[model samples]
Target: AQSVTQLDSQVPVFEEAPVELRCNYSSSVSVYLFWYVQYPNQGLQLLLKYLSGSTLVKGINGFEAEFNKSQTSFHLRKPSVHISDTAEYFCAVSDWGGGGADGLTFGKGTHLIIQP
Candidate 1:
């Protein structure tokens, strides 16, 4: 079984400031890590993912994350943020070897509040 934990429930940042959302996971077997973002009243959009081969992965909208096997972490970061970036961020994990029988387990979610 795999589980994801988001340390921060809310992150407040000024426009154009840098921000990072912390995430950690635990799994008995190898797993895939993902970050998803959801705007107000919208469905989740894939921000980034770490499936294999790379420790650092970049995604849409200037977002990036590093997979740290040692720390069991996949924290998401943005060099600079905009007001449009205000949304709920989620960290998720899914079994790497499963046949999609079990869906992804997601963290509670971090509300990204961008202050103008």
Candidate 2:
């Protein structure tokens, strides 16, 4: 079974300040990773993903994350943040295709708080 751990439950940052959300996963077998952001009254949106190839993956809204196999970490970072960026971020890991029969594993999620 695979598991994800979000280092921080909440991250508070001023509007326009850079922020990073730490995510670490534990799995015995190979896996695909994903990062998703969910805003208030909205569904989860794909932020970035690491399937194969490059270790660093870029996504929409200037968000990016690097896949570190040795460290088993996929940290999400944004150079500059906005008030609209405040939301819940989730990290996921799946061993087989689309979670397989075991289902996908997910973290508790990290809530980003943007302050003015």
Candidate 3:
């Protein structure tokens, strides 16, 4: 099993302003890290992921994350945020891939509050 930690429980940002949500994971084996966004009354949406190759990974809605092996972190960041971006973001990790039945250790979500 893998372990992850989200540094903050809430992050308040103004619309059109930059924002970052911190996440850290502990892995003893090769692992994949993921970021997901959950909107009100909606399922989780994939934000980004770090599997291999380059440390920087980008995803839908202009979200991105940099995998730092040294820091053991994959913090999600967006250059600018919209009021619609307000949601709960989560960080998760799994060793040994495949979507279904594969266990992913998830960290507590960070609520992103987009303000006008």
Question: What is the lDDT of every predicted structure here?
Answer: 0.95, 0.92, 0.91
TM-score of each: 0.96, 0.93, 0.93
Candidate 3 runs further than 4 Å off? 97-101
The lDDT of model 1 is: 0.95
Residue-wise C-alpha lDDT for candidate 1, range 1-116, written one tens digit per residue: 77889999999999999999999999998988999999989999999999999799999999999999999999999999999999999999988767756588999999999999
Using alpha carbons, what is the TM-score of model 1?
0.96
lDDT of 2: 0.92
**Better-scoring candidate (lDDT), 2 or 3:** 2
The sequence of per-residue lDDT tens digits that candidate 2 reaches over residues 1-116 is: 78999999999999989999999999988898999999989998888889899999999999999999999999999999999898999999888564456455889999999999
Candidate that scores best on TM-score: 1
Clashing pairs in 1: none
Q: Considering summed lDDT, which 10 consecutive residues are worst modelled in model 1?
A: 95-104
Per-residue C-alpha lDDT of model 3 across residues 1-116, encoded as one tens digit per residue? 57899999999999999999999999787788999999989998888888899999999999999999999999999999999899999999988654554577899999999999
Off by over 4 Å in 2: none
